[model samples]
Every structure is written in C-alpha cells, then in structure tokens.
Target: MRNAPLGALETAAALRRGEIDVRELAADSLDAARGVGAEVGAFAHVLEELTREQARTAAEGIEDARRGGTLDELGQRSPLWGVPMPIKDLTQVAGQPFEAGSMALRGNIATVTDGVAQRLLDAGTLTVGKTSTPEFGMPCYTEPATGAPARTPWDLRRTAGGSSGGAAAAVASGVVPIAHGSDGGGSVRIPAACCGIVGIKPSRGVVSPGPYSTEGMGLATDGVLSRSVRDAAVGLDLIAGPRDGDFMPRPRPPMSYLDSVGRAPGPLRIGVLLEPLAAKTDVHPAALRGVERAIELLHGLGHVTTPIPAPFTPQEWAAFMPLWSVGAASIPLEAQQEGELLELTRWLREQGQGYSGVDLAQALSGVQAIARRTGEAFSAYDVVLTPTLSGPPAFPGELQLPGGADDFGAQCAFTPWTSSWNMIGNAAMSVPLHREEIDGTELPFGIQLGGTRPGEEALLLALAAQLEELDPWPLVREPSAA
Candidate 1:
C-alpha cells in the first residue's frame, strides 16, 4: 500500500487497516523518490531524515489519538491525514532552506514558518520536501540555469512547465499525490497542463498570504497541483483559512471543495474561444484538437456550447504587456547584484529597470479596466473553455532567454491566455482531459477553464469532476527503478 500512488483518502483508509504504517510509507516514498526522481528531475531537495521524523511523529500522534478516542477508525482526523505531499520551493517551510531554483538564493533558510505551511502541518499532511521552480518562478518552462531542470514524467526531453515545475513534476512522477504551488500568472496551470495533472489557481485571497503579503496585486495566488481533483480539493481545505492580519479574505465557501467534485455541473452554457488574443500566432494542432475534444466531452456531459469570437483585441494585449515587463523588471536589483541570480533573472531585471514609474501605473490601471471588460464578457456564459497552453510541452531549453528583445517578445507570444486570467484574479484551472499526438512520444495536453471571480470551486472543480469520470488520468506508472 505504501508503494502505491494512493490519494489522501486512500492512504487514510490503508492506515486504518494497518496495511502500512506511516513510518513504512514515508521510508518507501523516500526510497522510491531516490530511485525514480533522478530520471524525472522532480525534486530539488529530498528531505529523507526530516520526512522520517514527520512520519514517526504522525504515527505516534495517531496512536495517541486512538488511545485518546479522538481519531476515527480510518485515522481520518482531517481530510489530509497521513498523506504524502511536496511543498513548492517558492513557499517557505520553517527550518528548511529554500533555494527557489536559483543559485542566488542558495543557503537561504526560513527562520519562520508561513501560514500555508503551518496549515498543512495542522491538517496532518507529511511534507516530504521542497520541489523545484524557475528563478523567481518567472517562466513557464522549468529550465532554471542553477538547479536541475524539471522534466515531465511522460517524456523526459520535454519540460515540466514552470515556475511551479517542481511541484508538477513530483505529482506527475508519482512522488506524491499532490503538491503545493503558487500561480503568479500561469505557474500552476501551465505545468499541470504540460505534466497531465490538475492545477487550480484559486481566486485571489481564497488562500491567505498574510504577515508577508501586499494586498490586491491580482498577480499571485497560492494553490496546489494534484493527480486527482479530490486531492486538490482536500489540500485546498487544509490551507484555505484566513491568515492573521490579511486585508482581503476569500469569501467563505459554504461547503468543502471535496464535496463540490461529485456534484453534477448540470447544463452549463459554455462560451468557447478558439483564438487567443494574438493577431497571428499559430495555434498548435495538438492544442486545438484538445479544445475540440474537451468540447465534445463537456457536450456529452450535457453542457451547452457556443463559439465566441475573441472579444478582446491585440490593442488590449498591448495595454497588458507593460505589466509583464514591469513585473519582470520588479525583480530586486540587489538580488541580481549580490545574489547568484541566474541569467534570466539578470536579464529580466535589466529589462525592468528601463520602465518609467508612470508607465507602470498606466499599465496597471489598464489591466484592471481590462479585467472588468473581460468579466462582462464572462457574464454571457456559465464558463469559458480554451486550450491550456498554446502548444504541447516545450523541449528542454526551448524557452530560455533569447538574445535581443525577441526573447521576452516570443514568450509573451507563446503564452497569451494564462496571464489574462491572472490579471483578473479569477479562479482558473488546467485539467488533464486529453493527450495530444506527439508522434510516438506522449505528453499530456489539457484545457484551461476559467470561472468568474470567487466562483472557482463551483465552476472549475464541478466540471472537472464530471470530466474526471469521462476520462481519468489516474497516477501513471512510475519510472522503472534503476
């Protein structure tokens, strides 16, 4: 049981039956990770000793709870009890050093634990260790110059999408059922689409980032990437509480996200947008095919579909581009000057350095107005479905910083859809609903589904549950042990 890719629920069940002890599970996971992780490049740091300590403590505490009459027969004290999961290197887990996939931040250890990390601990999930990310989590491909570039389990040559590439790789490789990820732009969904998993970027403030967060940027959100919909739902519940001293709180959902999964999505009037906001970028055949397939699946599930032409123009995209440059530029110069910042970091910082402050303010204000404009478009439908990534998994180093302005220019061209949702601070997800034809080589291609503000759990997961029943990408076989 410990060797299998059991979900949070299944693990709890096995623990109740004594099929495997928490210690045995932790040890097996560590061994399996050591054996298979090298091939997939899923983990940045594997904490064997720390994981064992956590498992040992969890086992003792469960036993104590049994004796204390507080634990159930299933050992299900919480939705996440006894599950093995990985925290993305971007989030600070106390007592652990966070490299964030950059040499610049090497040896940077967290003196304090963050709210999300503490919440996972409180909910009884055993974190194995930190997964990888690109430098400052700045790119959609995880080929950080410093750390190991995380690759997809399906095709080793292809990328596991970044900046949450490490977490996505860990899940795809079956190192864990689910892993923590932060999505500023498409960090969560891009890799999830590339690796064939579920990535949910909840509405801003759905999961708090307090004591260290600035309010209302609409740029970043904390979430998870998981093998199954239920796994993501379970993890969200554990970490969804409001943190101390937060300015904006996610409106409390009336029910748990797990409960939302099995509920039928009913007949949703979905508006399909075939073209991205670009004037002339080629939509990958695989990506278009994926959207077509998802449309069929959703229609079979009884959802009404209407094809809507691209409502926003490239002019609007021009309005949005400066924000990306501004964000890229906002990388602290001190880090670049002092820390061992990667080439991409230094390049982005240099690019950002040229923007005027008024330019940033204008771009930000335009983005907010665009969000409102897009929200009005969404008012016409229950949901909108589109290809998650414009193409299938990019080959390793394909998205590295290109010489001249063309490098950043090309990146913006490739990933046009994901950032728009981030701009609006809506709940968006990439679901592994289809696999594109990549010759004989197989990699997951998925569809991006976006919900209106604060309707993330209802719009995305409910549909995801329906689709999961139609075509499930259950944990695939792990890489053969060497």
Candidate 2:
C-alpha cells in the first residue's frame, strides 16, 4: 500500500536479493548515491576515502570467512558483511566529523565511536558517511545553515523532518539501505514518516548511549530508519545492547528482535489518539485520515482499537518546554561558540541558562509525574496508536524558527504527538501504511505504534511486521539503472 523508492534496501529481503553479493550491494548503494547526497542534503560529511577502504576490507573479510567456512552466524560474525550505511551526525563515530549540524562545532571530529555506531561497525556494515541533522537536534525540522534543507524523496518541496531528517532522506533517496537515527523527541520517526519508511525507536535503555547519557532523562535514545519493518527489526538486533557501566540497561531482551518478526502478537488492545496532543493547531485532515485508516487496518488484524484522551492536560505539556530547554544547557559551548549559534538555538540556551537548578528539578519532576500518570492510564492498552506526524511532510521553511510562527508553535503544528513517547521512554515505531493527498499532491504518512513505559520492544516489532505483511510497502520503487 506504500511505496519505497531509491533507498529501500529491505534487508530482510536478502533471502532473495537476486543472489547479489553483499559487496555488490555496497558498490551499488554507493554508485546510486553518487551525486544524490548533495541533491538531497542528507550528508553532513561523506567519508569517501574511508568508505572505499572499508568496503574493500569488508569484502575481503566476507570472502575469507566464506573460504574458512566460519561465517555461520551473521551480524555476530559478519552481520553487515560489506553493507554500507550512514551514522547520524548527532552521534559520534571514531575518525569522522561530528558537527551535529551546527556551525558552532564545524571543525570537531570524533575520536571515539558511540555505542550505536560501534555496534553497526562491528556487525560488518561499513560506515560510508555521517548524515545531516539540525543544530544540536533541537528542532523537529532539518534545515541548517550548513546545507540545503533535507527534502523528502516523495517530493523535494517538503522537508524530511529533523533531527534525523538527513538520514531519512538519504535512505529514502537510495544513498543506503538504512541509517542511524536518534529520537530525543520523534526525530527518527518524524523523518521516517516524512520520507515513507520504517523508523523504530527502541525503549530508551534498550540501546545504550555511552560514553554519554542524559543521566536517564528518558527523553532520547538512538534508533534506526530503514526500508521495511523486518529491516528495522534487524537494526534493533544489531544495535540494541548495554555497554559496560551502562546505568539503565533493561534486562537483556528475552528474544532477539529479528526473531520477533512474523511472530503473532495475539489480539492487542490499542488506544488510538487522532488529535494532535498539546499543540494549538488543528491536525491536518490528511493526518486524521491516516490514523482512521490505521484504526480500520488494526481492526482487520483482529486488534481492538478505541479512542482515548492524551496522557496529560495542556498545562502539563508546558513543563515539557522547560525540560526541552534543559537540553540546550547540556551542550558545551564556549562564549564564541555560543555567539555563533542560530538565533533560536541561542534563545533556547539562554532560556535554559535562566532556569535555576530548582526550576529544572521541578520540571523534570513534573515530566516524570506526567509519564507516571500516562503509564498508569495506558497500562490498560497493549499499545497506543497515533499519526507519526500531524500532517504530510511540510515544505521547506514552514517550520523554521525565528522567521515563522513561534518556533514552539510551528513545531507543535508539524510534530504534535511524537515527543510524548520520548518523555515516557516508550518503544515506538512509525510504519508507513498509507498515503494521503496534500495540497493536491499525494504523499506518504505513517501510523505510530507505541508501547507502554518500561516498554515491550519485541511485541511492538512483531505487531509492526504483521502490519507490514497485511499492508506491504514497496522495497525499492525506482532504483536507478541496475
């Protein structure tokens, strides 16, 4: 029912990927990517030399392992086996530029690989580049001063939502089959929805975030955007784990994510919310239709769907802004660096700076309280369904701050329901199940399925895969010349 052109690797389809060697896949991905990266503005920095070097090494490793007959286990032994992908600029990769899409950190390079990047690299995938993101990932849109806005493949007129926007565009435009993403507040799923793909954000502790963590704010976690639900499940298997000294790692999952695909998630009770929670603007009609369609589909799948109210009152959502501001306070900015930030970022940092420690503690307390209350209410349901975005992909500049409606206002209009999952530390996935016409043009929108607090990642994956089978999206709609 959904179309995937360009970046749809659908890793699970490797079963019958035309007998192409993984090395050939890497070469094809790179070749298809060539100048398209620049066109889509999906890359902050392309690791050209490193990619060629790594691809060769990976190819050799696969060949040697096959010759040695020691390639029994994949992703564990040679999981990636020469596949190529990009890491989000928000995270660090050893020897790669880590600009975080901010001019303020323009010259910075990472000397250490983060948990997500390290896991992917170990799984056998070659990191081809770093994808673009918004400055410090503060906003839900991806137009930075460093490059053109990250535009969706479905239409260049609209933005690929930030801060994982570039990764979504890159994957959507066929630069790679999959890419790393982070969702502090729907960054992964927003862009995934905008670009028409699968973006799965594991529960906060499922994917480790060290040698750095937000001290368990439970707001952000690493994730992946891929062509299919199965591929998303594979990504979780490859990247979800706890690092040494990781404070909040959940108990190791009872089963690997890949095993969950095609598994039955017996008749789930789902609470469906069609309204754009906490936002002042009305949800675009297209988004509402998408949710309604998802509800219908869920019913056909033998799941119970019921309308439910948002987790908290509008006044309670006010606490989220102060907590959001706290993220700005965490960036290590020198006076000069601070001066160089975009006005919205500067304002956010300044606003963050003005909050006293007590104010921050209180805000966090409020946030936790809201999460607790939501958890209690949602305990009755197996999952909560909402539109991943309140509307279709927005045109460039529609959600930009300072020049548009208030940044907070425009952001809420575009991304009304995503952040709440982050606040509650839920496992969430945006599955591209329908297309909606916007302003006379048809584009894809996603239905978000979120697990409860202390979430069930496997159940969510299994349910999504079942939906994918019922409503299969194209793996790669218009891959360039073979």
Model 1: per-residue Cα lDDT over 1-482, one tens digit each: 12447876777667655687988888877876666665777777788777888888778877877677776733444766777887888778778977777777777887777778878877677788788888778777786655688888778778888889888888888777788999887899989998889999888778888655555455888888988888888777777767667776776589888888878876998989877774347778888888898899988988998998776886776776566656766655454544466666666666667878898888888888888888888887877888888888887555665663555555555666787778888888999888855767666788988886555666688898888888776465454221
lDDT of 2 by residue, 104-169 (tens): 988898888877788887766767788889888988889876666687877777888989998988
Q: Give the Å shift of residue 274 in candidate 2.
A: 1.7
Q: What are the lDDT figures for the candidates, one per model?
A: 0.77, 0.78
For each candidate in turn, the TM-score is: 0.93, 0.93
Model 2 residue pairs with clashes: 4-477, 7-174, 75-79, 80-123
The candidate 1 region of ten consecutive residues with least summed lDDT is 473-482
